[model samples]
Target: MHLADILALRPVPAAALLMAITRRCPLTCAHCSTSSLLSSEEHPAEWFSGFVETIEPEDRPELIMLTGGEPMLRPRLVSSIASAARSLGTRTMVLTGGFFAPRVPPALDDVAHVSVSLDVFHQREVPRENVFRLVHVLAERGVAVSFHVVGSGPDDPYLTEVIETIRREFRDGVPILVGRVRAAGRARAWATADERVSSDRPRPCTMAAWPTVSADGTIAACCNQDVLDHRPIPGHLRLGHVSSDSWRSIRTRCRTSPLLRAIRTGGPQWASGRSDGGYCGTCRLLGTEQEAPASPAIAYLEQQVIHAQLSAGPAGFMRRYGEARFADLVMLGR
Candidate 1:
């Protein structure tokens, strides 16, 4: 669907929804957000279905983004989501780690896109051969595919080769985005902050341009910025929880937010704090707002944090995607 259509809606209905079907993932990357440590929480299929029922009928986003610890871990989810959107003539999409790439999406034609996260450890976790095998399947099924790459670290010498390979191979016409690791949960628990994390370079987050819905059922201004950027672990209202009041306040505020207004008005200097400088500022702000930095242990963990800049060919591309030699991305689940 056209993003312009969503932009034209009254109250500008959330352009899309982002939901994390499951927080459980197989691959343990270093800078994972969500601080995703709670693996024992079993997400039921019905929970997903109920979440679906919560999206406001008027704002049924044309695109639905399913993410997770690794969304593919939840079997039959992609299919179910597509079916729901198709029932409303909308399209569904997913951000997978290529766990089930070769699998067929049940509701064949309703999927709009499938973004596969291809990082260095991808092969180790999901197996490399399986990823390529799945990508081929997604292509045949007509699901538009994009690559989400996590860059190689300064501590890891193998990263340069991996990035060059991606630039040469998968980056042609296919959308490419870069990202950095935030030592939220497991990453914070184990990984040490890398030198690359301290650059003041700027990056753009396009995810904000689209509407996002969280798994628990709340419509959000953007997915990546949800709880991570919000002050209070972000209330679940946007996830379809205590609707009306929360989002009523948030949505209204977003429309007038200087940042949002700037982007909408084509202000040359748009900022969601997507810079090492801004991220740092925002992080400090988060700490102050939550009284979170007091714990010496967490402070030490933040000290171990690494922030760096990446190359984004597209103007709004995120740069945490380190330069690496990974060209072949295997899509494991659809």
Candidate 2:
């Protein structure tokens, strides 16, 4: 979505502009969310630069997220992205596999924060020693560090190792945000078994600030727009082009409409909440640990999901949704 058209959707001061610089990824994690992999197209650096220029001084945001299968793979990318972000008086953050962290230009370190993906897949593609090196470099440069655990994949034999590693990191105060794999394209077809989940919990609360603009630039009331409405962010959507519309009020009503339903479970004994414990039944069962020795049930589910995907061609689903309209991280509103 065009940046101007996106801002017209709602006044979101804290926006997470998810710029998928490149979809090419070296690691094929078992549970890959967003499924942005090799062969993905990158928006032109000029396009992004123009976007940064379009942000009025008054429209500065708290954070702008640069993500993708691996954003660092863009050969031409250096401080160009960081410079565009810094020019707007906003803090820039990046999500990377850390394989190319060492190659990051020295100037990009200032005013940029990084969230490293450190799952078993990351370990395989990027040496642990290398990840530590990247982390140290970024830390020395004063960039904030956070790690995301990609656990929703078929139970890797290394489940114990992954959990153990993340636990230690969490204990040390390095923030650990558990990422729910969203079912898009191939992930969505077998979502039941694969459980491409997210942190967004259906709430009775109002989404006053959250809004998302799709790649085509149409605006939606929240981040779940693609999942629910299947509408392009800046273009085709349930609420077409909110150019002159008061997006604040429109989004408010849309968020609370009784006839409308989001990805929510009803009543008790149903799945709900942001964390695992908050949900009941199937949702809780997704990752619940038993007192007895771990069985292969969960593992089987993961395999079954993959097997079904393989048989049906998982690539089809992966190709369905290219990228998120916005990258607020949490809540469609930033």
Candidate 3:
């Protein structure tokens, strides 16, 4: 599966599952999204594989994305999940820090796609050369590969330089998904806050569409780092935990929850009827408010919004959620 193929399904509800297999990472990059270290909490391997096992062949997501503070750390778990997902007709993708760069993990054989983290912050810990080498080997093996690049902003010189270099080195064989640094994890203290969504008009939040399995087995409605870190996840955003809930139940709640449906169609600002807090901030507050009553109109609106989003394609998704300047880069190797 190509990166664009995976991204195209991003807006669809329950189209994919994101599992953070482990939180422990060897590289302590300054901008680490999970602030992962060797000591960071990692749950039992069964908590992850058991969930994948629950995904019945007839009712499974189109894709299963494995992520972590570093997913490569648990090679065996990656292989297990990928093999099971594949058997159920679900494609699998892995996003890694490339700490094991220049050496392709054997687990990668079971996956369909691989995205390596390559950015200024990551380069401080993981050499870009080693990451490039790893990706090259994976590409040669017929496993689709892409780079998840991050920078300070669209105008960041680092983005310009690295993007050009990747294109040059790979001869445009590898696609790049460029995004700006967010105020999360280690970067929270310094990284500027992302622009807030205004309540004036409806702004659909695509992030709420997928279910994210966190390190401790808790499954959240969205992939926001804060939502994943909270001890008692907000009622509305909380899907059932992996330890107790089956994939069918989690996906059903994700699609049927009125609040999530509203958020996916009109965003947290409209769903919670407040935008004083930023996008995610307002989403967090929804737990304190009454759940949005379900209605046929809301359901209709969600389908309409998803249709419009599907029309926009992957590059369009990048323009809205990622840096617009490099949005088209996602289509580089398509």
Task: Please count the clashing residue pairs in each candidate, in the order shown.
Answer: 35, 16, 0
Candidate 1 residue-wise lDDT, 63-147, digit = tens: 6667776766665766777777778766776777765555654543456776677766565666655665665576666667666
What lDDT tens digits, residue by residue, belong to model 3 across residues 248-305? Answer: 9999999999989999999988887777887788888887877899899999999999
lDDT against the true structure, per candidate, is 0.47, 0.44, 0.92
* Per-model TM-score versus the true fold: 0.60, 0.55, 0.98
lDDT pick, better of 1 and 2: 1
**What TM-score does candidate 3 get on C-alpha atoms?**
0.98
lDDT of 1: 0.47
Model 2 local distance difference test score: 0.44
Runs in model 3 lying further than 4 Å from the true structure: none
Instruction: Supply candidate 2's per-residue lDDT for 119.
Output: 65
Q: Which residue ranges in model 1 land beyond 4 Å of their true spot?
A: 1-13, 35-38, 43-47, 54-58, 101-110, 152-160, 163-173, 189-314, 317-334
Better of 1 and 3 by TM-score: 3
